[model samples]
Target: MSVTDQHGNIFSIFNDLLKADYGIWLWEPYTEQLYFNSHYLTMLGYSNAEFPYNIATWKALLHPDDANNIVPMQFKIIGSAEYGESFDTRFRMKTKNGDYMWVLSRGFVVCRDEHGKAIRLAGIHIDTDTSEAIVNKLAIQHERMRFALDTARDGLWDWSPATGEVYFSPRYVEMCGYQPEEFPQRVESWIERVHPDDIEATVTKQLEFVNNPEMGDTFECVYRFLAADGSYKWILGRGKVTRRDAEGKAIRIVGLHTDITELRNTQESLAHLINHDTLTGLYSRFYFDEKSRQLKEKHYPLSIIYGDMDGLKLINDNLGHATGDTLLKTAASLILQGTRGSDIVARTGGDEFTLLLLNCSGNAANLILERIQAAIDIYNTTPDVLPVFISFGLVCANENNTSVNKLVSQADKNMMNTKLKNHPENLAIIRAWIEKRLGSEIDIADTRLAQVHSSS
Candidate 1:
């Protein structure tokens, strides 16, 4: 309906009451006589005739910013009366105490002549402070929502099933590195980007809720989405089915989409640490133990090799701990490279490493051990602080007759024997190697060693 028809209905309903929360007045351009209800006079701190009674008088009471609009609208209502055009606008008008408050004014030309000219204008005013207060409240709520979305690194979206329209707030598009308008405005755009593995399952879950309408149908899931940059990002989607039609069909869904890429990355990293060693980046002892148990149960023949860096302590004391760590990692890498993909390598303890070889016989284990020794010899020839060599002890076992602890103990004994055979010449050489590899540069005197022995 036109503004004229709307205002006419309002005036017709309340004109007889002569009592509106807002002021009501009519001005005759020719006579300049203004007729105002008691409320109108009260608005200006005047009783009937107590003030100059005309359009000029009322204009003086308008708020400064509203005067410009009020003047033009007044003339429009007067001029457009023959066409039944009316004016409905909101402006600030001065109150009896000279304080200005918002008012909604609707004016119509009620009396028109045969020439289609306007003779008299009738209008009503409603104090819109209550309505204005409501609007301001909504505006504040909108601002708070905007702040929450911005600061929490969250995105928001609205989907209308009936129209097949999807609206994404700026944050939603920006998170995926796209302009707001660049993305398609359909649910298909969202569904098509979900990771293939998760898409069907996620859709099934969503459709279940859609088909069976529930007041609190909260759908939540995490899935990968193809970003505008062509990289896939993990997103945590949470939504509520907000609108359902009379037939109980879902018509709209509104919710938030948060980029959980970083969170997923952190989870993957933690998972890796849980199963793998932090230092050597090999399967951890826990993983080895679990896998060994499974392998034994499955009756798989496995060769277990336990090794320790032969001169780690000497190297650590002579060089630095950093060098010692480098040597350990280097040895671990070589051991890993020598093993088959099916085998597991682990850093079992400080200066100790272990390996589990699947389907490998004792002869095969020996061959691998020789290869590891050869790799160490080659590594030592490099100019950088040569990685101290590793000494390995192997125990071959199968489900027929095997014990993990017994095999490990046998390997440990062999490692001890190997270390003894390769011991450096003098205590000074041992101490020097330890200092250099272990970040400690202290040299112990023979007198101090004698003192320690005597004290013991």
Candidate 2:
């Protein structure tokens, strides 16, 4: 009987070791049988029902740039060369949602023929490198890394898998706020201090390094480790498999840790600044455009409302720019009050704004329009300030005929039409406000105002 017919349960061999916390794959070269755990499917945002578990199907999801390297390595792992018994590399694979993620793939040959040919294989796929900074943190040369580690308040750890013992550096005691005696010694003791959320990935990387001697000696992972205090600190743990048994299993591992909490916080603050408008606190145009492109592939309706503040130049020219800024801020506040919480309001330009209304119907769009006009009217009810007027145009888009560029063009046309329709009344309102403000200089202002109105 062929191995395919006889060894249906061969995939279960890896189950005892991994317990499904990580994504595992099993294959037999002679039978061409491939099996992947459900975790593997879930990691790529797919279900076995939706995705086939064959080499060709999986290869189709590999990023075009990665397929060239990944496919050849797959074949080489089970080839005639006994030294090529391990498969290791990083590659980008597509998720079910049409996005790509970088994953570290490592495999080992589990069975061989009498002639030392490979017959069966097992491996894991690790979702790593969630952030670019995570990868860049490991780029330093040996001397620079050692010098920095020595200067900074860093920690070191040494582990022996066979003896089940661990060694913690004195710096580790300082960083953890622990006494020398209280520092972790056994592997299990150290494992208890890792934050619950980070324990799985941290342990998996350790297993990956130990099991595959053919992979490089280096191992690195970032996780939150609990300190002697009640708090947890983000630690970048990098290590090397310093020794391996005759069977290629890891015997000793040693590494260092660097505190990265401040770096993480800074990155988060910078990210917020990138995605949000500094002046208005609303989403930026770049964020809006990015989201709009993502939504293009989804089946949903969107209401695009484009708006421009009217008479801003007039206000700035007559009053100071400070007054103009206040007017812009006031407009932004009223717009936010008029729209729903789910709506994405952005300051796209100096005097322009755009709102992306989600799942919005025609009635809902009309209601939003009325609410904004009401807000403007209520603001105008206050005395002494220049009247605030903003011209708006809207277009409803659906899956049938909608795209980012098309929606923008149509909304712009509508906005121009609305602006033309509102210009005369808005001009009159501005004229009234200017007449009221320029009491002593009315004669001089009249000439400039007349010129403005004529040219406008």
Candidate 3:
């Protein structure tokens, strides 16, 4: 009889003996073929035709946690005689009803080649979902815990104080881009992976929590961990003492490590958005106000450089808003480049900018203003899309009682005076520059008329 006929006959005999409570399977390792009897199909809520009878199908149904650890052992048993005649393992297998059932798989090599290679294997599957054995209960609990951790993208860890040994779950090992055997099961193994800068603080906090149980029930910390690829990843570690000594010292702890790099980056981005101008990449008025208050508390010599763009409205009216935006961005870049990194450059209004210069006198302010003017001169020399011009006013507050607001107002008044004096000339220059750059296709008449009317 053919192998298929023989397997069918054997399956029929076992069906009578086990009364459908158990399932049988036959595998050909050389051919990578698989067979599941009718009882096996029925146990998983599927008919023989509904399920694909293949090794891949069998592997796909195995729980991920079990599969990672078991696949190699399965190969070792079939490929060598080290496992000694038979192998048995308990794992969760997905049923057709979308739930996992605990199963006990027992198998042995049924046939071998002339060279003593195991070509065929046979296994019996026993549903252990309701088994009363302690081992079975533990296996079921472990599978359930694995499901929860995998779903939450968390890695579980258990540490023993007595032996200094640590148990890292498969997911935990994989989180660091490591195989289960790659990472040693020791507390030092985990500590060694912590980034050097964070290790001291993390260890101190952990020790504090361990020494004082009354301080809190749970300990939490966030730090960077070195992954297998040699890159650091942000991890949030949280745990509680599950076992304690008579003196209330922590003896055993169970915890989880979660990858929080994305969340941390998102939080940093939100904080930047809150304190910075979205368009100009300068400090927003809100942040400027806060810094102003802080600088006022320290009685340092402070200088305020108030600036207004000369012809934004003219540009917006003749060219598009996009062109107007370019003018604002260029002004921002020039101010940033001209000022010291310590100086706070802010875009506080539509066409207005302010600089907070700490420990700067009026002489220092003048030099900065000169630097800005030089930058503008260079920009104008390059026949760019738009001509750049800015009116600036500087005021220094050295007195202990001098209010920042008063200095700001004085700078604003001075800036307005300069703007008024240069507005007419700046508009005429802009008109000529645009006409020269883009030719007669652009209209400068309406812009020039608006400038004259505004001056009137």
The most accurate candidate by TM-score is 3
Q: What lDDT does the true structure give each of the candidates?
A: 0.66, 0.70, 0.74
For residues 309-369, write the lDDT of model 1, one tens digit per residue: 6556655655678877787788888887677787788888887888888888889888888
Model 3, 14-49: lDDT tens digits are: 233334335667665643557666677787898656
**Candidate 1 vs candidate 3, TM-score winner:** 3
TM-score of 2: 0.53
Tell me the TM-score of each prediction against the true structure.
Answer: 0.51, 0.53, 0.59
Models sorted by TM-score, best on top: 3, 2, 1
Query: How many clashes show up per model?
Result: 24, 0, 0
**lDDT accuracy of residue 455 in candidate 3:** 75
**Model 1 lowest lDDT segment of ten:** 1-10
245: Cα error in model 3, Å: 4.4
**Which regions in candidate 1 have their CA more than 4 angstroms from the true location?**
1-153, 158-165, 195-219, 239-255, 271-278, 286-299, 358-371, 381-387, 400-403, 417-456
TM-score between candidate 1 and the true structure:
0.51
